[model samples]
Structure formats: structure tokens, C-alpha cells
Target: MVKLSNTEIRKLDDAARAGWLYYVAGKTQDEIAKKLNISRQSAQRMVALSVSQGLIKVRLDHPIAKCMDLAQKTKKSFWFSIV
Candidate 1:
């Protein structure tokens, strides 16, 4: 694998964050630009960079997954449950 320079690393970091904000947080390009203090065009470019570089991933989570996770957490936690 090719090593990234400091500038490249920073760019990738920005792209990853922008991609997450867009995909995960459901932020628009304009919102990302406002939050990052960059132009909307730059925000769109960063999101595209993340996809081109394979920084984003997609997975389907089963609805029961959340219930199972909660069960595990309850098993470990000291808190009392009302249910």
C-alpha cells in the first residue's frame, strides 16, 4: 500500500469526516460547508473523495440487533430495569 503524506492524510481525514456527516448524520453539502467553514463545492468534493478512496462502508443491521445489544449491556450494567 502507498504511504500518505501529511497533506494527503489531512485530506483523507477531512474527506472521511465529510462523508460521515453526509451519509451517517444526513447532512447536506451546504450544511457540511457551513460547519467546516468551506465552500459547498469543497464539501461535495470531500464526500466524493471518501467514496473514491473506499473510506465509507455499508452494512445492514437487523432490528433485533439493538435489542440484543441492550440485553448485553443490561447484563453487564449495575442499573435496575423497570421492565
Candidate 2:
């Protein structure tokens, strides 16, 4: 599991909803903002955060395995010790 900052954790639900509203329900950022009672910029940022944080996948056409490669590199860089 990935660790989340307090703010990121708090936004997870909204981010998921925002992405769904934009992608599945076909809502514009302005519409989403109205529905979610947030600023349009917040709506847009939530949609992007959902994708960047992997809260949801807007499409399945892209390969997620490439992300796994980056994860491995990060683990090697930060968590592994030289022997």
C-alpha cells in the first residue's frame, strides 16, 4: 500500500468522484464544480490528481506495467542498502 499525506488522503474520495464525473458522466469542469460545490479549478485539479495518484484509470489503453518499472527504480534508490 502507498502512504498518503493528510491532504491527499482527504481528497481521495473527491478525486475519484471528479474523475468519474468528468470521464464517465461526461461532465465539464464547470459542471463538475457546480455539482461538487467546488471551484472549477478544484474540479480540474481533482480530475488530474485522480489520474496522477492512480485513484482511478480514465482508460485502460495505457500500460500500467511501465509505472511498475518506475516503482522498482524508486524502491532501489530509496529503500535498498548497498552491501
Candidate 3:
């Protein structure tokens, strides 16, 4: 992995916080901007940057039985795990 300077680290932290506020806290860009003491456009960019940097992850949780069945079938067909 590449090392980040303090400024870059600070920006990534801000972007991650903005993403959490918008996605997890259900805040709008305007709200995030106000809460973070940044401009709305900057907040938008931060959220986008967070996603682009893979700082935000989305998962779909399926029941174990369904997931297991799907995984088994996929493995049988493909001879490898897709999960």
C-alpha cells in the first residue's frame, strides 16, 4: 500500500466521516456540509471520494440457507467458489 501524508490522511478521514453521515446517519449533503463545517459541494465531493477510495462498503445479507444453497450450486457448476 502507498503511504499517505498527514494532509492526505486528514482528507480521507473527512471523506469517510462525510460518507458515514450521509449513508449511515441518513443526512443530506447540505446537512453533512453544515455538520462538518464545509461547503455543500465539498461535502458532495468528499462522499464521492470516499466511495471511490473503497472507504464505504455495502453488503446484502441473505439468510444462511439461501446463501448456502446458492453457493453450493455455483461451486458445483463452476468448480470454484464465487462467494
Candidate 4:
């Protein structure tokens, strides 16, 4: 891992806060920018940086079993290929 200088650490912290506000708090980028006292473009960049630095994590939960069963039934009943 690369060492971060104090300024870099502060920037990362700001980015993480911006990301949390946008993702978890459901704030708009404009709102985040206003709240953080930064420009909209800066807020956008901070959010992206937070994601790139692994400060943000995203998980998608899918019902694969249910979907597969429904697809199989549909294919059997309709004789249609589901690819």
C-alpha cells in the first residue's frame, strides 16, 4: 500500500464523507457540494475518488434460484429458448 501524505489523507476523508452523503444519506451531488462547501464538479470527483479508493462498497442481491425456476417453467410451457 502507498503511504498517503496529510493532505492526501484529508482529501480522502473528504471524499469518503461525500460518498457517504451521496450513497447512504441519499443526497444529491449538488446537495453534497453545497453541504461540503465545494463545487459540484469537485463533489463529483470526490465521490468517484472515494469509490476508486475502496471507501465505498456496493453489493447487489439477486434471487437467482427464483429467476432460474421461473425461466425453466416458462421455457417448458412456451417451448421458447431463454438464453
Per-prediction backbone clash count: 0, 0, 0, 0
Better structure of 2 and 4 per TM-score: 4
TM-score for each of the candidates: 0.68, 0.61, 0.70, 0.73
Cα lDDT listed for each candidate = 0.92, 0.87, 0.93, 0.95
Candidate 3, residue 60: lDDT: 62
Q: Over the stretch 1-83, how does candidate 2's per-residue lDDT look in tens digits?
A: 98989987778989999999998889999999999999999999999998998877644455886786678788788997433
lDDT by residue for model 3 over 1-83, one digit each (tens)? 99999999999999999999999999999999999999999999999999999999877676886787788898999898674
Provide the RMSD of all predictions against the true structure, rounded to 1 decimal. Answer: 11.2, 7.9, 5.3, 7.2
TM-score of 2: 0.61
Query: Which candidate number maximizes lDDT?
Result: 4
Off by over 4 Å in 3: 62-83
lDDT for each residue of candidate 1 in 18-65, tens digit (9 for 90 to 100): 999999999999999999899999999999999899998766599987
lDDT of 3 at 47: 97
Tell me how far the alpha carbon of residue 42 in candidate 1 is from the true structure, in angstroms, after superposition: 0.3
Tell me the deviation in Å of residue 32 in model 1.
0.2
**What lDDT does candidate 1 reach at residue 20?**
98
Q: Write the per-residue lDDT of candidate 4 for residues 2-71, one digit (tens) a residue.
A: 9999999999999999999999999999999999999999999999999999999976567886788899
